[model samples]
Target chain A: MASKVVGVREFDSLIPLLRDRGYDVIGPTVDEGTIVLDHVATSADLPIGWTDHHDKGTYSLDKRADEAYFGYAVGPRTFKRWLYPPRQTILTIEHAETGLVFKPEPTADERYAFVGVRACEIAAMEIQDRVFAHDAFADPHYVERRARSLIVGVNCAVAGETCFCDSMGTGPECTAGYDLVITEVVSGERHEFIVESGTDEGETILTELDGRPTTPADRKEVRTIIEDTAASMTRTMPKDETYSLLTENLEHPIWDSIAERCLNCTNCTLVCPTCFCSTMEDMTDLDGRAVRKRRWDSCFNREFTFLHGHAVRFTTKSRYRQWMTHKLAYWYDQFGTSGCVGCGRCITWCPAKIDITEEIAHLAEQTREEVAT
Target chain B: MTTTVTRRPTVAVWKFASCDGCQLTILDCEDEFLSIVGAIDIAYFPEATRAERGGPYDLSIVEGSITTVHDAERIHDIRAKSKALITIGACATAGGIQALKNWADVDEFAKIVYAHPEYIRSLSTSTPISDHVTVDFELRGCPISKHQLIDVIDAFVHGRKPNTPTHTVCVECKLRGTTCVMVAHDTPCMGPITQAGCGALCPAFNRGCYGCFGPSESPNIEALREAWHEIGVDDPHLVQALRTFNAYAPEFKEASETYA
Candidate 1:
């Protein structure tokens, strides 16, 4: 709960310290021309001095003047992959002499300390937590992984072009759902991190760092940085009205127009932080050893709605509508929260540059016109 | 649940008008080939063995397309003899790149390439084996995936369905953690419309997928064309990308024709 000001070097030392404490440090690194979440050894492995320019269907990494480690917005990947993997074996079956023996996948014991996690991503994780861990039939693997993982979140210094976290009431600042949170403040000749501990484990790590108490000036700077980020965000969705707007407009012509631009590529859902739909695959080898794998499936796929040997949603219009409506509207009925975290990965990574915020605005505009009539 | 052991299932491989790549994929299963031989009888495979056995075969794996009158008739004969006929590769599944002749005059092409056009007794339009006879299953790709080929064989030997996915290449890219080329670098990719089988190869290598694997289950080509246009990929390039490998696949052929 207490905030402390640590030198940039002290902040970098946390990686090795976490590693020493039996945590695999997962952090943001430049890989294949984009910032990606990967196995990070030290702060040097982090995308130091790198800032990414993100817009509708465009992303390019650029070097910043300051050596800001967490300068960029969220990249193609999020903390979701670490928590809920793209593909994982759920069960394995073997043919025994007497009968067939069934075995569930062993619960993973490896602890992960995810570094440079974004605020919106934390919100996405919380949404997934409710899906996998809080349900009546909780996923033991997800529950175990979530329990063991330590989140080291970073407050955004710069808002991405497609980001609308401020409007979603999820970000620009690391508000909750982090063990430890950092605000990188670079002013004049001094470079420091205003770090705060949210849990006892975080407190223990913070105390070990031996950082000085945050002065009023330091706290003021962190606030200014967060405020500036919020101000920088230009793209926004009308979050409060999203539920009713999407639910009410089932037959709206806007979906047809959106479908024309949408490729139904599954890029948006795959890159999205909170899209948790999956399909099961049963694989049997020649030896009669069978394994059942749970792979990430997208609602954009025609087969996602298959029933009675026929696809329920056969057209692009139906699939896209289901994806967007389920994310913005029907998710409230099912999960009591909006599926979208406003991270803007879907907008940035869409080959068609289909902006969710723009689509919502269009729906809102059409609704206003109907009301006026 | 117990079935008595009888004669091993007999298999025959047939080729008509393709580059022997798909048959090579059968050979490419070097590790599985020995076990495949142990499980089933390779009754007739001209590419692999000298000895030939007559069918009344259990399963016949066909490659290539019906580009010639003789090959077209031969496919019907093979279908009648075989209990189950599985077509493999883009050639057998969707008529391959040679089906581009469907858009052009085959006689004109023959006259230009051949010394004597009269000597070439070819059909007007190259068509898939399914056009001539009943096909049990179709394994799709430019050259079919080795793992999938093995799966098809194993599934046929045992009475089960193969686990070949009909999802887009975009799904494969995400599963493998490859960043989308079109999104990251403005590279126009056909992965959104193309089927998953090549493991999203081109995008993983930082290049756009040229779509060697054909259209996905629901190929939204018009939308992809628009998306490609936004990224400065003109109509000509989009059309060319669609008219490759699996060019004559109904979904791709229709989209390419619209563009043309």
Candidate 2:
């Protein structure tokens, strides 16, 4: 696919084009103090020239010195909330003369064009795709939603303090899994975007837009910006021995130390873009009509691992260990990839400010000490 | 030809020594309350209806804490007559804000609050219902969310375990996609140690979670205190955080005492 350069002023044209192609364009918009994903009608809705300062258990939005769209990192919310909603009704039942009549709720196949998606988020979506659509039994609702959705990826110009995507090898640049990829360029007095088509749909959308062919200099500038982002990231994960490091140290003392600070709040899993655990609920009306719904569940919850009459992971230590290990180690065996995308929503949102990268690094240090001894 | 008659399960709502916030939550379920009433017999709900029915009740939903000697005895009788006794709100489950008295002298509290200390009657400590009698289940919250309350009623009525979550407020915040106040703003939120029920209300509004739902299952309070300390949260503030609504809960009580 060929790349094209579009002026920042002309970027608004893509909204109407996406809407014309029967897509409800959803993009990042500032809600309250943070940027949240919502329906975008114009280019003005995007958080232009705005950046956010984020740390472990901290985030603050600020105005940028230059005008650049998609300036911030990922927020507390993820694209999964759109594809697989927090609460969804699966089956409805009614009392009949014989017994009960069951009716499966029809899936709403709304075509969504997700704008301003980050590289780490794209990786997170792929992880979820494997979990829901490519699993042993595919979830029909998730499959329908995934099939109808169109991803418009945005390369990160500035990484948050908590971001470790470079080490995770998942981000700072949107490489694949997107229909269209965008990289914003902010030179003195001029702001533009270097856009690339990753799919036929993206190519068709590009043809509708008023954009010029990109020069070699323009492509080189985009490359430089992505390289700078990757270089600026301070956080990193122990990629090589992460699986064995975690699995082997199931009974490590570090687990106990981290467990003490872990509220077993399940905040990490909840904010995690790739965490896909869910639980079923049966609700009945006064008229004896019942609906079976599914809501997002977390492993940190004792009820999540309930078997027979007792909880399996009864302690906070066990639950925290389970979540971390599942994300960094066990996930490789299950999905052939690590669960974490290094977006760091968990670190930012955790009340205790527990950093996963720090935990992984600590474990790696322990491994080094053991090897040295 | 055969004729069949089915009787609705009898439910009784009881209160102890705390605010009627939990009972108000039941009334707040306006649309669903009608449906719930249609399915169950409201045998005794002093807050809603005056028509009282005697038990052996099929289900008893108890609110508030056992602060008075009389309340302490009354819960045992209620437990004996009810098939299933479910404690709702932090009061009935952990002891509520009044449990702050657990750290101080109850006699001194009576002297300060009451004009005539002789007229006042209260136990040394406000205790959860389970401390006195067996609780079939417990729904933790400052004032329990109505949706969860409905789940408990529906589940008990259907002879099944209620699907109320035993997770922390973090899970709810994640589900709602609310920004983390603690992480983003350096605000100390109790979402991690707190139980899930209030839908992560405080955090959603850019405030820290006060742990209104009490401690989650196996909460590591010592570690949380240490973490908070590292974040510059002083010992007094940490103690005050744990000594809030669910102060008498074993986990919070022990954690608070460490700081005290």
Candidate 3:
């Protein structure tokens, strides 16, 4: 995997090249006063010279000092929006002359090339791949879309205030689960990308670009930028201790305090890249036509744990505990890896400003107290 | 087609103390109105037609709240007559905006608003239909979504439960990929505690949701209040916000009382 140096101007051709290669390229673009993952026809559609500031319950877009294409932290949207849509029609039923007919809904089958994908997001995708793709009863929709899609990983150059990827060992560096990985380097009066191919397809696309052999200076700049992003992260979760600390303290008093501020809004779960839960709904029209749709569900929802004509997790404390435990503890038992990639979308997007890293720290502190006693 | 004498399920629309917005939602179902009419017999819909038929109704779609003693008595009678009574909109489900009068002295407000307060013959409180009689189902919203209204009727006619979700507006916002106004713009939004029937309307336009669809199932109003407080919305403002459309809804009512 030899890395190549692509000049800022040459990088402009990347999106067009992906489009020409028959991909519906989705990249970051400014929308609704924030960077959003949307259709990218050319490199111009990228959130160039723009970055986002992320903190608990806050995200604001700001102008960057340099014209760096991949300068921003992860936005509200992730690649999950495409691979695992919030709502999807799984089956459609219509009345036929002979009898009622049930048919599987047709999927779009578009080849997707997602650009500007962060390293933590790549980790989330791998976690989802285990859930939706590797399982015995694999979801055809997710499997098909995932197989057809290509990921272009972007190593973080700037860490958000809520980010704790370095602590989680997910990354500020693009390590794996990518077809092509890139690191945008911006020096005074110069902007370029050091790119490497993780797959043959990525190499083919890289060959099409006007790139030169990477120099030592380019590699050194990429390393420095990644290291800086890792260093800048102010938030940290005791990642290894989260599982035991959360699972053991099932009835922690801290949960009640957290619940006091937890809105049960489902924003955290909805914005999370790895949180995957869905519920099916059958919609019927007057005309004998019924469609069953699978929409995203969250543990924070009261009805999410409904059983025997009543919700099991009736309190905010229970719901919040369920979500946090499942994300940090139960997820390890189920998927062999932590559900949280530490991308921090959950913290940033939470309307109540509930921080996962902070909660985990509280749990660790409480556990330490119990052990001392 | 052979003419069959099979009687359709008799449908009736009843009103109490609302703005007729929920009933108007029925007429707003322009494309489906005729089909709905064809499926069920509109025995008593004074808003749409002059024809008035007494129930023994198969389905009674009730709108508004029991604002007066007469309306309160009338709801019990309507409930007894109808096989299934479906309460529609905020007025029928959670007492609507007029329920703000529940907290204040109605007579005092009437004296200020009316020339002769003595002329007004109303109850002290505006209460939802459920407060008086057993309501089979309730479709909550200031003005109920037309699509959901149709679903209620369709489900009633077909003998099934309606598909209206009782989740928070945040679920709908996420489903539609609308950015959180409170999180992204520092706007005070009630979407976290508000129900999803309006399809997350306000937040889509970059405006905070005003809880027009009423408090969601098991809504955490206290949590929302604390969140809003952090964003500069004080207790008074939070109380005022909760006292909107679904003022008398137990969750909002209790939360507002705490703040008040």
Model 2 agreement with the true structure over B46-138: per-residue lDDT tens digits: 999999999999989999999998988999999999998999999999988988877789898778889999998888988899999999999
Q: lDDT ranking from best to worst? A: 1, 3, 2
Ranking by TM-score: 1, 3, 2
- Model 2 residue runs over 4 Å out of place are B1-5, B112-115
TM-score of 2: 0.93
Give every collision pair in model 1: none
lDDT of 2 at A171: 91
* DockQ-better candidate, 1 vs 2: 1
The predictions' CA RMSDs to the true structure, in order, are 1.8, 2.6, 2.1
Candidate 3 backbone collisions, by pair: none
Per-prediction TM-score: 0.97, 0.93, 0.96
Best by TM-score: 1
Candidate 1 chain A: 10-residue stretch with minimal lDDT: A281-290
Shift of residue A29 alpha carbon in model 1, Å: 0.7
Tens digits of lDDT, candidate 1, A133-213: 996889988899999999999999989999999999899888998999999987678788889999999989998886899
User: What docking class should model 1 receive?
Assistant: medium
TM-score of chain A of each: 0.98, 0.97, 0.97
Candidate 3 residue-wise lDDT, A1-373, digit = tens? 7678899889889998898889999999988888989888988888889999998898999999888898889888888999999888999887776677899987678899999999999999999999999968889999999999999999999898999999999998889889999998787977788899999899899998888898887788888988999999999988788887887889889998998888889999998999899988877766557789999999888788889889999998999898889999899999899999999999999888888898888778878888999
